[model samples]
Target chain A: METVILMLGWVGVFAPVALGVIGSTIGCSRAGMSACGAMLDTESGYGKFVGISAMPSTQAVLGIVVMFTLNREINTLNAPGIFGVGILTGIALMLSAIHQGNSVASAINASKNKPEIFGLSIAPAAIVEGFAVFVFVFALVVSGAIPQ
Target chain B: MNSDQYITLMSALPSLGKTYHVDIPPISRFQLEKRLNLLTEEHQALLSDIESVLHWDHLNSHYDDSELIQSATLVLEQLTHKHYDTLREMILWRLNLRTILAGLRYRQRGDELNHQQSHWGVGDMEAHIETYWQHPYFNLQSRFHWIASVQESLQKNDTMQVERILFDVTWQYLQRCSSQHYFDFTAVVTYVLRWNLVSRWSSYDADKGVEHFQSLMAFALGEYQQLSMGIVVDQNGDSK
Candidate 1:
C-alpha cells in the first residue's frame, strides 16, 4: 500500500510534464505547418507565423513548473490530491494547447492574404491562451492545499 | 485541404477591390487596361475579348443600347468561364447562377435554352437544372424553391432585379459556408467571391458601387462574428 501510494505520487509529479509536452508537440507542429504554408504566400510577415507557432510551447513550460511544485514526498493523504490536480491540469493544458494551435493556424492563414488583418486574426488565439492560464493558476492554487 | 494551401491560392488572386473606383467611368479603355494589367497572363484571352468589344463599339458608333448590353454581357460571361477550373467552387456557383439567369431570359423570349449565347465550362447549372430542381435532397430542394420564388421577376424581364437576387443568394450561401468552415478554404473563397462581386458591381453601376460594397462589408462582419464564436466545424467532425 505504501509503495502504491509512493508510485501514485510519482505519477502525479510527472503527469503534467508528459501530458503537457505531448499536447504542445502536437499543437506546435500543427501551427508550424500553417506557418510554412503562409510563407509561400507572402514575402514578409514570416516572423508573425513563427511567433504564433511558438504559442503552444508555453503550456509545456507551465506544465514543467507545476510538476516541480508538486514534487515533494509521497503519502496516502496527499497522493490523491496531487494526482487529481496534476491529471486535471495536464488535461486542461493539453486541450488548450491543441485548440490554440488551430486558432493560430487560422490566423496565419487569414493574415497571409490580407496582411492588414494580422493583428485582428490573432485575437482568437489569444482568447484560447487565456483559458490555459486560468487552468494553470487554478492548479497551482489548489496544489498548495494538499497535505504534505 | 490544409489552411496554408488555401491561403497560398487565395494570395494569388488579384485584389480587384483596390482597382475598382465608384468615380471612374465604366468600360473606359484606360480602366480596362489597368484591370487587365493586374491579371495574370492566363487571363489574356479576357483582355482580347474586351478589346474586340471596344473595337466593335467603335466601328458601330450608332449601336443600339440593347446590343451594347448584350455584347458586354457576353464578354463578362466568357471571362467568367475562361478560368473556371482555377477558381474556387464558390465561383462556379456564381457563374452557374448567371447562366441560369440567362436561360430564364431566353425562355421568356420564346427562345430555346440550348440557344443561349454564353457557355459555362463545367459545373454549368443549366445543364442539370432539371435534376437540381427535382432532386430529393433537402438542400437542393430548398435552393430550387428559393430560386423559383424569383420566377415572377424573371417573367417580367427584370434582369437587374433578378441579377441582384442571384447575387444576394450567392453571397449568403458563401457566408454560410465561410461560417460553417471558418478555418478551412471556405474563408478565403468567401473573401474572393466578395471581391469579385464588388468589382463586377462597380463596373456595372458606379453610382451604387459604394453602397453595395458597404452592404458586403456588413455581411462580412456578420461572418466574422460567426467565425469568432467557434461554431464552425469541418465535414469530418473536426472543429476547424
Candidate 2:
C-alpha cells in the first residue's frame, strides 16, 4: 500500500537521524576536552574543530521530526515525484547525518594543527550539513505545504 | 612647565623619534617636562631623606618590580640622575631574562620529552618547535598566522597534535610556556558558570554561565600576551 511505503520512508529517516546523533556524540567525546576548556588541552589541539563539528547534530534531529509528521500525508498524496521524493529524501537525510559526523571528525582533526582558527575548520563542516538542511527543506516543498 | 610637557619635548628630541615605536608617549610635551622635573625633584628629596636608608640593592631586592621597572644607577650617580638608569636598565634586563628563561625552560623540557618517548622523535620535535617559535619579531599578523595554523591542523584530525604545537613553538626558542594553563583557569570558571554547553560541560545554562565565559576570555588574553613576542599591554590595556 502507498501508506506502507510512506511509513517505511519515515522509519528510514528516523534511523539515520538517530545514527548521526550517535556518531556526533561519539566523535565529540573522542574529540576529548577541546574548546570547552580543561577537558581538552591546546596540547590536544583539536578542540576548536570539535566545537564546530558538534553543531550540525541539530540538523539530524530536525530531519527526523519533519519526516515523521509528513509520512501520513505523503501516503495520501498522488502528485508527481512525491512518493519518489519521500523515498529518496528519506535516504539522503540519513546519509547527510552520517556525512556530518565524518566531516565533524575531519574538522576536529584539522583543529589539531590550527587551534586558534577554530572558525575555519567549522565552516567547511557546515557545508556537509548543508546537504541535510537542504534535504529537509526539499521534503517540505515536495510535501506541498502538507495540505493542512 | 609641567613635567609631562618636558618629558614629551625631550622624547621628541629630533633624533630620538627615529626609533620604530608604535605609539606616541602617553604624556603631552608640557605635562611630560613637568613630570620629569617633578620626578627629578622627588629623586633629590628622596635621596636626601634616604641617606640613612640607601644600602639596599635594587636588582637583588626581595621586592618584585613587575611594574614600570627601568634602571638608572648611572644617572642615580649623577646627583640629578641618581638611580634612573638603575631602574631603566633593570626593566630592560629583567624583561630579557624572563623572555630568555621562559624560552630556555621550554627548550629544556622539549629536549627531555623528545629523548623520552614522544612519537614525533627528536629531530622533528626540534624542527617543529623551532618553526613555531621562529615567529616575526613584531607583527601580530605573523603571530596570528602561527595561531591559525595550529587551529587548522587540529580541525583536520591530525594525530599526535600536542607534540606538533609544542615542537612548532620549540623551534622558535621555547619562549612560550607549554604547560597547559587553560585547565587551571577553565575548570574553576566552568564550575562557577554552571553551563556545560557540551555533554560534559552541559550542566550550566548559557544565561547562567556567561560570567564564566567572560572570565575564560580574560584568562586567555593573559596567556596570549605572555606567549607572544614583542607585544606588550600595560595594566590599563595600552599596547606597546
Candidate 3:
C-alpha cells in the first residue's frame, strides 16, 4: 500500500509542471503578445514592460522544483508541515502565474492610448506577486534551513 | 516651409484625413527666449550630475524615468542653443556630442541621446528650435502621432502629450510581449529587440534586451561621456 502511494505521489509531483506548461503556455503567450503589440505605433521606452513579462516564468520554475522536493519528502515520512508547504506553495505558484495574465491583458489596454503613463500598469503584476512571496516565505518555514 | 511653419503644422490637426497638424503656444520672440532660458539652466545642472554617475556606452532607457529624461533632454536643447554663444564653446561642443548620442537612445536608454549635433553649426536658440522642429523623426512623426493625440484631449498639454504617447506605447509593448505575437514583437521594440529571435529569448530574460540590448546600452553610454562634465553615474547611482 505504501509503495503504491509513493508511486502516486511521484506522478502527482511532475504532472503539474507538464500540465501547467501545456495549459498555461498558450494563454501566457497570448497575453504577452497583446501587451507588447500595444506599442506597435511607438517603440521607444518599452524595454521595461517586456522585461517583467519575462520574469513571471520564475513562478512556474519554482513550482516544478518544489514538486520534486515534495515527492522526496512525502516518501520519507509525510512530515505534515512539508505537505502543507507543498500544497500552499503549489497553489500560490500556479495562482500567481495564471493571474499574471490578467495584468498582461490590462497592460495591453493601457498601452495603446497612454504610453507615457504605462508605468502604472505594473501595479497589477506586483499584486499578483504577493502570492509568490508568500510561497517563498512558507517554503522557508517548512524547510527551516539556516544560512551557512 | 521653415521650422516655425513646420511647428505650426505639427501643432495643428489632420483636417483632410492624411495630413496632420500639431498646435503650440503662439510665442512671441521674447516669451520663446525666456522659456528657452529656464529650460537650458535646468538641464545643464542635471546633465552635469548625470555625467558624474553614469559611464558612456553603458546606458539604458529604463534606468531613468522617461518623463524625467525627456524633459531634461528638451531642456538641454534649449540651453545648448539659447544664449549658447554667451557660454564657452566647450559646452556647445559637449552638447553636440550628447545630442547625437541621445538620438540613438530611442529615448534615454543609456542616459544619452545619440544626437551630437550641437557643434555641427553655429546657432542660437532659434536655430536649435528650428532644427528640433525640422527633424523628420522627432518632429514630423513623433509630434504628429503622440503630441497631436494628447493635444486633442481636453485636459492635455505639451508635457502631458509626450507622457501620454510614451505610456500608451510602452503599455502596448508589454501586452505584445505577453501574447508572443512574433510580428508585433518586432514592431514594438527598439533596435535591441528588433529581431524575432531576440524577442523569443527576451520574453523570459530577467532583462528584456536579449543580446543586442547590451550593445545598444554601450552605444548610448559612449555618447554620454562627450556632454557630461565627469563620469556620469547611471540613474541608480551605481557604477557600470
Docking verdict class for candidate 1: incorrect
Q: In candidate 3 chain B, where is summed lDDT lowest over 10 consecutive residues?
A: B11-20
Q: List ranges where model 1 is wrong by over 4 Å.
A: A1-6, A113-117, B1-153, B156-165, B185-240
Native interface contact recovery, all models: 0.15, 0.00, 0.00
- Would you list the rank order by TM-score, best first? 1, 3, 2
- Cα distance off (Å), candidate 1, residue A79: 2.0
Please write out the lDDT profile of model 2 over residues A77-139, one tens digit for every residue: 432234455555656655665555545544554444445655676666578777777877777
State iRMS for model 1.
4.2
How well is each residue in B87-131 modelled by candidate 2, as lDDT tens digits?
Answer: 333223323333333333444345433334223211112333445
Which candidate has the highest DockQ of all? 1
DockQ of each: 0.10, 0.00, 0.01
TM-score for chain A, prediction 1: 0.95
Better of 2 and 3 by lDDT: 3
- Score candidate 1 by lDDT: 0.64
**Residue range A12-114, candidate 1, lDDT tens digits:** 8888888889889978877887787666545787887899889998899999999988989888889988888988888988988888888887777777767
In candidate 3, position B84 carries an lDDT of 38
